[model samples]
Target: MIISRACPTCRSSLKLTQKDLFDDRYGSPGKHSVFSCPKCGFGKTIPGLNRQNIGKFYARYYPLSNENPKEM
Candidate 1:
């Protein structure tokens, strides 16, 4: 049962699940995995990276990744 939603930035249909990030270095069973919108190639890493930090990844890890800003 994947929760599907439209990308807020690209408006592409997003159906996210654990299987989508099988070999990811950033996500895990505990962390949330954010997949990309195939149309726009918008790769987002859904946060909650830290146990103590929640609902604040935008200010927390979003900028530190140093990856493509649009993708982050």
Candidate 2:
């Protein structure tokens, strides 16, 4: 069941929508459902994602950068 989230910006009701599951912009893998406030038009990633898997996913899928080779 989809649950509505409260907008942090305006305290309005937010609705979940299908969004790109993986976000690799930061060189870390992320899986999230998109939530946007209908009233204020605010948007953000849904909360309560599995925190435990973040480290593992990042370690495995984070992109390599020559600028910070130590991170690899």
TM-score of model number 2: 0.49
Summarize candidate 2's per-residue lDDT along 1-70 as a digit string, tens digits: 4644888889988888766677557654456778888888888776644678766565666646434546
lDDT of each: 0.55, 0.69
Candidate 1: 10-residue stretch with minimal lDDT: 23-32
lDDT per residue (tens digit) for residues 1-72 in model 1: 344466768898865544335435433234347766778776665542455554354544345555665686
Local error of candidate 1 at 67, Å?
21
lDDT of 1 at 1: 34
Q: Ten-residue segment with the worst summed lDDT in candidate 2?
A: 63-72
Judged by lDDT, which candidate is best? Answer: 2
TM-score of each: 0.37, 0.49
lDDT of 2 at 44: 77
